[model samples]
Target: MRLPKDPTPIRTIEVVPYDPAWPAQFEAIAAPIRAKLSPLALGVEHVGSTSVPGLTAKPIIDLDVVISSRLQLPEVVSKLTELGYVHEGNLGIPGREAFMWPDGNGRHHLYVCSVNTPNLHYHLLFRDYLRQHPDKALEYGQLKEKLAKQYPGDMDGYSEGKQDLISRLMQEAEALSGFALHQP
Candidate 1:
């Protein structure tokens, strides 16, 4: 039996070796958002594989715009819009909100989550754990490389594939950090 080639254009997924400049890039992206949202935004945190030193990633920076409470969500959304980010309304994640990046700056993912959001804790814990354990980070990097090749062009497929490992690592991260996931 012959399988037909799918007509959908495969979006290129490029997983590259960890770049030392990722931290600086994060800082650059965070600075303005930090400045614009001052007092409202608790902090713009760098997470994801890019934030983990020496971890292979898709090169797209991931950030969390933390707020003190959900009461601040409206204001945060308004200000981020002024900063050139269009709010994407949590994208099915309850506590966190996603955004489209501004034109003319490098590509990145921006998320907003209040202090008690589990998503926020997940990202921080996973990134911090990977930073502390280089061996595990390397293992994660290898996994990402393999998955990128296996699921190239299917972004959803790529993300779904990493869930099992992500879940395991999240558990390890939570245990090590002693931080329990909580809802807002």
Candidate 2:
């Protein structure tokens, strides 16, 4: 019989009331990143729970920097590193390279993805769908709140709990957008 590994100790999940200031905070972080990446970035967008207005989230902004090709990743990473973002590889998600700034700048997540990558499209679609459908966004926010309470510091458990809802939403989003949902 296989035993489960001990959960990595992480800060407890904290879902706060939706803050009107989130967009400005996201822009504050995104602008500098976009300026630095420049022509290399086909698009830089805020894509995540915080992007949806009135959605209660964990107060971390998620930004996607879309590039034109995989060959461009090395230069993109080098440029971002010069600006103080530590490249953390793909973090198990292919086509989306993740990065983290040393603590204190802001609480945020960054991903560099190719323009043609399905993950990039999914992020945008999900964000747009939630923005257009406040009812669904509220439902998702409640689910997140419940899961955060249930799992506490267990990030894996919290994410796992949301898989079903995310899948359902993604399918709906894909159907609405006429694009197949692609896993990354």
Candidate 3:
């Protein structure tokens, strides 16, 4: 649980067409992690673009392994480490801890977040919104495509560029889901 001396480099952003196999890929990755964490993991779910069917994405699965409290985070981090993931503390987002698998396992982003955190809720709400609205998902896919092209080598820029769109979508999603948007 020690931080690396150097930061991980931002790689070029590459968005690919929707792959039907993405869900299965998530299951393959989640199963073992879930088994290892057991009750400490309130739930483990696939979130982000890969979770929605027919949405073009970067092809990296985004997962959230939820816990009941922040107190459990260290244990979760230890468990994930045993599974070969390096804990990469929140990466600027509070209420969630990021983890990266050693090179070559697969392309994925994993996070551990407490139940009911705004960040976690946002992820679920946004994912479900896209799932229920194909047209909106298509719009989102298009946005990602444009952003990826504009910020080809800048991951931060790509993500930053999507903030406005994501915020608007999240507001709509929060209304639909009856969860007040929590801003950090």
- Compose the digit string of candidate 1's lDDT tens values, residues 59-140: 8999999999999889989998998888878798888999987662457999999988888988888888999999989988
lDDT of 2 by residue, 1-184 (tens): 9989768546889999899999999889889888999999987899899999999899999999999999999999999998999999999998899998867445999999998888998899999999999998999999999999999989999999999998999888888988887654
Off by over 4 Å in 2: 1-8, 182-184
Model 3: lDDT to the true structure: 0.90
Which residue pairs in model 1 clash with each other? none
Candidate 3, residues 1-184, lDDT tens digits: the string is 9888766666789999999999999999999999999989998989999999999899899999999999988888888999999988999998889998988456899999999788898888899999999998999999999999999989889999989988888888888877777654
| Candidate 2 RMSD computed on C-alpha atoms after optimal superposition onto the true structure | 4.3
- C-alpha RMSD of candidate 1: 4.5
Which parts of model 3 have CA positions greater than 4 angstroms off?
1-10
Q: What is the lDDT of candidate 1?
A: 0.88
Q: What overall lDDT, based on C-alpha atoms, would model 2 receive against the true structure?
A: 0.90
Rank order (by TM-score, best first): 2, 3, 1
lDDT by candidate, in order shown: 0.88, 0.90, 0.90
